[model samples]
Target chain A: MKNRLRLLAYPYILWMALFVVAPIVIVVIYAFGSAGGGFTFDNFSRMGTYLPVFIRSFKLAFEATVFCILLGYPLAYILSKESSRSQGILVLLVLLPMWMNFLLRTYAWMSLLENTGLINKLLTLIGLSPVKMINTPGAIILGMVYNYLPFMVLPIYSVISKLDYSLIEAAQDLGASSAGVFRRVIFPLSLPGVLSGITMVFVPSVSTFVISQLLGGGKYMLLGDLIELEFLGSAYNPYLGSAVALVMMIVVIIMLLIMNRFGEGEEQAVMI
Target chain B: MRDKKSRVPGRIFLALIYIFLYAPIIVLLIFSFNSTNSRTVWSGFSLRWYEKLFNDDMVINALYTTISVSILAAIIATVFGTFAAIGIFNLRRRWQSPVLTLNNIPLMNADIVTGVSLCLLFVASGTILGFGLGFITLLLAHISFNVPYVILSVMPKLKQLDNNLVDAAQDLGCTWLQAFFKVVVPEIKPGIVNGALIAFTMSIDDFIISYFTAGSGTQTLSMVIFSMTRKRVTPEINAVSSLMFVFVLILLIIINIRSSVQDKKLRAKPA
Candidate 1:
């Protein structure tokens, strides 16, 4: 009976092998195989042209991750302290915007950050000159931060809310300062959530083609845009695109591994 | 009074975060009703754009396709994934861990990579299958990405199942399959439902993967909006977006309320 039950998983296993595992092999095949249909490192060799793009994508993603940490950590911390009823409501509010179609959320910013957007209109009405907010790296970073902040907050909040209140009480009774209690006990305990949050925010921010295009106005070419350009956009080169994607996959895996090694106790915090 | 006074900063900080999160959505909502053709300049509010969205064949077709694909993908993935989770749960630890790791690929990989890789797979398979990328491939891609989430959601519930429950049903003279249906299905129904819900939510909101696998022959709502966005301004998209926002908002609210009520009942139960 047990064997028969385990046999039920075989069909799904076959499905995943075809859909999930095979495609990754194909990505590698295309990445390494040259246009002439022979194995070559030419695709990777050609990545020099996109060196600036790689740098800018990582730089911007890093900046956005930092911003999310600064903005989200406090929000999650405070949210952890709220009454459970209000906590549910507030957490929903944080997540509701994310459930809006990804494009719609970015498109929301397109209207807000444009030269004649609502923000600019507000500025002008107040007798201030309109600022050029759209089609810049800053706009792209802002878009990344805006879209992924909830990814950061939700993990941290889940971790912190479940923290042992008795630990804090013990620290306070032992004469630790409130700041020291938070710094030593709370922050250290919440590191898993923080680490997972960094992974969640950074990966998407780095790999986002839409946020850069819609917000950066095609002026800046990040790794995502570069990959898109090869596959679906103006440039029709999947080999080079595969190379870029492979590089990104490796980088992301390495980052996640390092972080996982540090504190992934609540790594499942991300599924929330 | 002093304690409340000291709490003002955290409250203000949270308020500002909320504003940052909502300001863009509010802008999109406000523009959806703009009377003038322009998205930037707001005249008196009008329902013209919403009316236009209703009349627009492109938007309507995309919406139809989007809903169809999401529903199909969610249901199919949930069925396959629930069985897969049960199977994995019963497997030896050695094989189970490897399969679980494989399951994380779709969730962990960047959407673009997943999209591009799947696009390649469909194109390659189409050569032998005599079909190219289209609605079928699009639906297939949605199901593929959604299955991992379903498996993840259901596995926990399967683990929570009582060890003696299945045996108890079998000893009562039910066939193994009958025992599973009679005993196990009811136990894991919540998980199956949760998996389906997550699958649906992920599918409906998906763009990047769908954008690639969908091909030129088909379009999801995300693809349509993306095309509209290429232009400087398209007020119809704003109207459609506002509607989507409200629809999801309502759906989420209902789910949230139901879950909270369930939580209350669970808590109220005597231990």
Candidate 2:
């Protein structure tokens, strides 16, 4: 009976083997293969030429992650303090924008950030010089933070809300101030959520092509843009794209592993 | 007094963040009503863009493709995922862990890598299958990413099940298939439903994966928006988005109500 029940999974297993696992295996083979159709280290060896793109991608992703934590932690903490009904509605609102088409959300900013855009129009109205807001590194990072902020907020908010209120009361009863109670009790207990939140924000921000493409104005080339160019754009180098993608896969995996180590087996609140 | 003061700042902070988040969407929504074709200019209040959006064949085709793909992918993923979740649940601890790790690959990896990998797979297979990237590949890739969410959703419900329930069903003269279908499946229906909703949402919102796998022949709604963004965008996109925003809002509200009602039913079930 049990075997028959397990037999039900055979179709799914077959599907994942074809669609998920086999694709990665293909990426590996392509990553190492030469254009002439033999094994070669040329792809890895030429990676140094694109080091600046790698650095910029990581640097921007890092700054975005930091900003998400700074902005989102407070937001999550405050959100958790709300009544349960309000918390549900607020959480939904926080997540609703992300459900909208990603490209539309990014394009909305494009109009606002253009040189003759609304932001500039408002600036000129105040007798201030127009700032070049669009197509800058700052704009790209802003895009990342705005899109991924909910990821940071949701996990930490879940963790903090689940923390034992008795611990906070216990600390206060022992003469710990409110700040001390939060710092020692609430914050430490919520580290797992924070760590996972960091991973969530950092991974997507690092790998986004459209955000950089639309906001960075073809001036700033991140690894995502580089990889996309190698694959779909004029460059048309699948081997090089595979190599970059492999490295990206490795970096994301390593970061997630580090996060999981600190997250202490709290289930990833991925459903939202 | 300190508590009240802190509360005031907390409300302010929430207000500011809400403003930050909604500003772009508000801007987009307002411009959809602008009379002129220019994205920045507002000649007068009009629905010209919205009218244009519905008439454009490209927009209509892409919208059709987007909806069909999302629905098909979500339904298929939910079916496969629910079965797999049960199978994994019943597996030995050692085997289950490894399967779960493989499952997380899609969830954890960057969208670009997943899309590229799948693109490579399809291109390579095209040599034998005689099919390159298009609607088929796009649907397949979406199903791939979406299945993991379904699996993750169903796993928790499986964990919640009483271990001996199936056995009890069998002892009550039910056959193995009957026990499985009539007893086990109904228990995890909520999880299955939740997974489908998540899968649908993810499929609808996905851009990066769809961008890579969609190839040149076909375009999803986001792909159309992307092409527009690359050049000077028309106000027609704004109209499409406003309609989409309302459509999705209504869709989500309906789904939420259905699920909450189901949840209430589950609670009312006698222990």
Candidate 3:
């Protein structure tokens, strides 16, 4: 019976090898070899030309991650302070939008941010000048923040709520002001959650093609858009696409490593 | 007085954040009822788009594909992932971490990279065999991506499980399989359900991977919605979005209520 139970894993192992392991192996091979089947360094050489794109992707993703932290930290803190019943409902509210189709949510932003859309119309009604919100990097950043804010909030909220309240009371009794208590005690204690939130927001934002495509109006291309274009666009080159994907995989792995370093000796509090 | 004053700002901040989070969904829902196609102008309330949405062949086909793919992928991933979790749990302690890390690779990798890599695999396989990209490849990709989430959710529950219960059941003249089904399965049922739910949502919400692997002929709702963005999307798309939102909201509310009731029952009973 034990042997049979062990045998239950064989099919799953086979499936993982074929679908998960083999696909990534193929990407590495394609990244190294050319379409003509000869080994070449041309793919890596060609990636140098797109260095600016990589920089821009990382920059925008970093900006978006910062915004998510700023906005989400306060909300999470407030939620964690609430009664348990209210906290459950508020957390559900945060998660509700996430369950909606992300493309649809991003598309909704298109209507709200367009020049003649809802925000601009409201601005005109109130005698304010309409700002060009769509088709810009700022708009893409907004979309990223909107879509990923819950991911940022949930982890921090989980960590903050689990914090020992006695520590805060102890600090206050020691004549530490509330601000100092938060900065010195709360923030440091929540570093694991904050670091995980940054990784969660940054990794997806850097690699997102759809959010940029919908909000950036194709004028601003991130690394994800570049990789998609190579595979599915008119510039269909699998080798080049694989090389770009390999680079992205490396960057994401590095982010995961950073997250793991901070999350060390914890119970992996990060969840999507 | 100071505590009350501090509470007001916290309340206001939460209200504003809720507004920010919900504004787009509210606009989408409202637009779904507009008579005219213009998103900003609410000329009058009408269900014309909702009516049209039912007859739109492309939208219906994409919905069919999305539902079938997600359901099939979720079920398969749950079964395999549950057994795989059990197998990993029973392994010698040293081997578990490496195998679990292998499981985490799909969960950790970016969606675009996974999509591109899988596309490369399928395209290569197509050249070797005479098959082309279609529903099968899309289903396979969805299942592959979903299994890791299932494993993650189930592994935690497996760890929390008391293995001695299963041993007790087996010693009571039950076979190993019977002990598993009667004792272990019941204990880990919540995790299995949670894993399946995650799998279903991930499969439905996927776009980048589905876009690459689905090819031109077969499209999920996400792929269709993506293509619709290239043109001036009709309000029918908004109608579909609103319906999907309502469906998911209802499903979530039911789950929340059921779980809360269970929580109450658990609390009411003595530990």
Candidate 4:
């Protein structure tokens, strides 16, 4: 049986070799090699060009992560406390938007935030001045929260659902206040889920050009935009694009390492 | 006693969050049927936009491409991912985690990066293959991204399974192939199905990857919708968006039903 199964695996081995393994191999090689002439340090040396973009993308990602955690924690707690049937419905609600196309979800925000859109229409009807919600940092942040909130909510919910309520009760019996119980028990127990969600949101938000480009209207240049410009825009510079990609990868690795450090103590709490 | 007032505020907070989450989608569905072109005022609801959506040839082509790519990607991902999951399980226990993580790289990496890199690969290959980027390249890209999800889903089930069952089947004089098909396949079927469902969703919902890899002729529904919204905030898009919203909603319901039934059956089984 094992031998037969091993034989069946060859097709998948070939598939991964051609697809997942090969494309990444090409990128890693090209990241080191030069663009036109030959292998050189030219692309690596031009890292200075992407410095501002790295900062901007990282800062925005940081802001989005913070917001997701803040909003998501309490919501997840409530969801975990709900009955199983209601929890299923709540999960479906959170995941439904995720099933819709990313671009569609982004456009939904566009409809909401456009000058003549629903929000402004409502504000004007209410006798308040219409606010410019599109093409701004705030709009981009709103889009980020809308699109990425599920990542935060799902992991935290998973952890909270699996939490042993008896531990909380025990803490309460020991005369711990509600806040104290949360801080000492629930919070620490849920940190792994929090880490996973944070990583999920942060990585995408930092590298996401679509939200910043569509919502911020190209006024805000994030790292992904910079990479896109080099590769596809008028510049058409693959070398510089590859360099920027490498830098982005490094930044993500650093972010993950930080998360890993903080997550070490919390790994015991992983619910999934 | 103090928790009662606190719980009221918590309930209100939950209500507000639900309102935030669902309001945009509700607005989208409502405006899709608005009779007037303007969104500010709602005239009597009509189906004009839905009619227009059917007549748009370009939109039709995009939907065709999207469905085609998603199906092909789902099939390929399920088959390959199931095989890979089984293969990794047959290996020594210690090697599994790293192998699993390696397979997950394509998932964890940013979609835009994957899109760009796949574009580069296609661009490079088109030179050798003498075929410009189109359906084939798009399928390849979708398969690459979808496979990781399949693996992630299937591996856990394979890990939980007992290996001795397969060995015992072989001891009973069944051929290795027979044992694999009759024993191993049934054990992991749920995981494989779940993986395929996720792959289907991911393949259909993906915009960034599809945007880069798909040529003009192979543009998916999302690409068309994206371009349309960029140009004009038309109600036809809303109509199509609402349709899509309903389609996914139904899919979610079906998945829930299947899962609950499976849960019941599993609980009924003796451990």
Q: How does each model score on TM-score?
A: 0.96, 0.95, 0.95, 0.93
Query: Over 4 Å off in model 2, which ranges?
Result: A256-272, B263-271
Tens digit per residue, CA lDDT, model 1, B114-181: 99999989988999889989999999999999999999988998889997988998898988888889
B1-271 in candidate 3: lDDT tens per residue?
Answer: 1467779989999999999989999999999999999888899999999999888899899999999999999999999899988887776677678777788778767888888888888988998998889999999999998988888898889889887888899899898779989998989999999999999999989888899999889999988888888886877778888999999989898988899899899899996
- Candidate scoring better on lDDT of 1 and 4: 1
lDDT (tens digit, per residue) of candidate 2 on B1-271: 2457769989999999999999999999999999887677778999988888889998899999999999999999999888888888777787778888889889878888999999999999987889889999999999999999999999999889886998999999999889879988899888998899999999999999999999999999999888877876788889888988999899889988887897899799975
Instruction: Write one digit per residue (lDDT tens) for candidate 3, span A1-272.
Output: 55566666667777778888999999999989887988898999998999998998999999999999999999889998888878888888998999999999999999999999999999999999999999999999999999999999999999999999898899999999989999877887887788778878887999999999999999998999999999999898889989998987787678678667756644343221
Candidates in order have lDDT scores of 0.90, 0.89, 0.89, 0.83
What DockQ does predicted model 4 obtain? Answer: 0.58
Local error of candidate 2 at residue B222 (angstroms): 1.2
Error of model 1, residue B75, in angstroms: 0.3
* DockQ values of all predictions: 0.83, 0.74, 0.73, 0.58
- For candidate 4, the TM-score of chain A alone versus the native chain A is 0.91
The alpha-carbon deviation from the true structure for residue A121 of candidate 1, after best TM-score superposition, in angstroms, is 1.9
Instruction: Kindly give the stretch of ten consecutive residues in candidate 1 chain A with the minimal lDDT sum.
Output: A263-272
User: What is the DockQ ranking, best to worst?
Assistant: 1, 2, 3, 4
| Predicted candidate 4 versus true structure: per-residue lDDT over B83-185, tens digit per residue | 8777877655575566667777787888877887788788877898798779999998998899888888888888788989988998999887898799988
Judged by lDDT relative to the true structure, which candidate is superior, 1 or 2? 1
